[model samples]
Target: MGLEIRLLTARDTEAYWHLRLEALEREPKSFGESAGEHRLSTPESATERLTTNPEDNFVFGALLDGDLAGMAGFFRYTIAKERHKGKIWGVYVREDCRGKGIGRALLAALLEKIKACPGVEQVSLTVAAGQSAARALYVSLGFKTYGLEPGGMKVGDEYLDNEHMMLKI
Candidate 1:
């Protein structure tokens, strides 16, 4: 399969929304947002999000044979004091596509774009505890764990912890 990594655009809104909901539903504990919440979001919102500013906010998508299979996002903090930091969010690879390094390619592309943004010194992300593969991927990319947030998410009476990690660019 041909793998292509590129910034997502408004034209990809529908596919991106579907993939995001799939991520939320299939791996509920992996994200901070719930499928229920995402279901309430409109396509217009997704389009707006995809219409990003490369300098501060953007999403990278991995397409396998022209199909959206993985995605990663970045947004620099807007607050004056936190402007030097950015956060990675909504990282997911389709279950069928997991073993192909799509996530790594998506992240590497996102990180390369983040590095070009002015004043962004560090990038931060949170991975749900117990997700060994995801954590391992982040570590392989030079992310260092800084702390853990207990009970970061609650799904059907089960509390999930999140490990905070950061990479300095």
Candidate 2:
């Protein structure tokens, strides 16, 4: 069967949980949250995350054979004046499923969701510095790096930097 790209929901909690844990564990510096922080998260909260409250948040998933293969999430600022922009985060593809366009698919779908939002005119995201593949992917999809956050994160003693990119919708 072909891969399916669509919105994730509360019913996808089980698969989503495991897939997200993989992202946190396998690519610690690439994400904002550590696996330990996510491990403390409850299943109910994960499910709640999948339940889209479109004005502010949504998640898109890429599935193959009914398993979650990748995902991307978007969050819009709820403050009155900042609603015109959104941020994309939590982008990941399953290890065994990489190099197969799943991440691009998830990102494309997420962008479409953002376009559907009435006031969202732009979307921004941050990628770990030196992550060429992911940065290239975002660049290929029309995102441009506007700045860099030097030593944006510290994992143990290693300082991780990030590149800030934005796309005009």
Candidate 3:
């Protein structure tokens, strides 16, 4: 897939908001933020949310046919002592766009961007434990499973385990 990956900014707020809401509603457990929380945000607030520090925080969008097909976000740990560690979050591709290497390409592009940030020695991300395909994709990209948080995420009455993975970039 000759996917066009772009780093989004404040100007892309509308598209980002819609796509993010879709991802959250479609796959709730895959994300930490709930759609309800995001629904509380107005377009004005979305501008603030979408506009982030370019050097340490940003989102990568995978565009196929000129549409926002997928997205992934990267951010540096905010704590002073954890400045060397970065995090990859909010990785999701549209259902129709899945299995086309879009997700993989988005991640690859995100890693490439993370590489440009000095002092970022390692990157970390977490996935639901049962998502084998996502886990395999991360592993193939050189991420190792460091730990598993049992019942890390609770969805209604059931709890889902989360796998913590890290890449020594």
TM-score for all models, in order of appearance: 0.97, 0.96, 0.94
C-alpha lDDT of all candidate models, in order: 0.93, 0.89, 0.87
Q: Could you give candidate 2's per-residue lDDT for residues 1-169 as a string of tens digits?
A: 5799998888889888888999999999889899999999999999888775755798888999888889999999888898898999999998889898898889988888799899899999999976788999999999998998899988889998989999998
lDDT (Cα, tens digit) per residue for candidate 1, span 2-53:
9999999989999999999999999998999999999999999998888856
Candidate 2 residues lying further than 4 Å off, grouped into runs, are: none
Position 144, candidate 1: lDDT: 99
RMSD of each: 0.8, 1.1, 1.4
Screening candidate 3 with a backbone cut-off below 3 angstroms (N, C-alpha, C), the clashing residue pairs are none
lDDT of 3 by residue, 12-118 (tens): 88888999899889888787788998888898876765575678988999988778999998889879899999989889899998998998989989999899899
Using TM-score as the yardstick, the better of models 1 and 3 is 1
- Considering summed lDDT, which 10 consecutive residues are worst modelled in model 3? 45-54
Which stretches in model 1 have alpha-carbon errors above 4 Å? none
In Å, residue 73's CA in model 3 sits off its true spot by 0.4
Clashes of each: 0, 0, 0
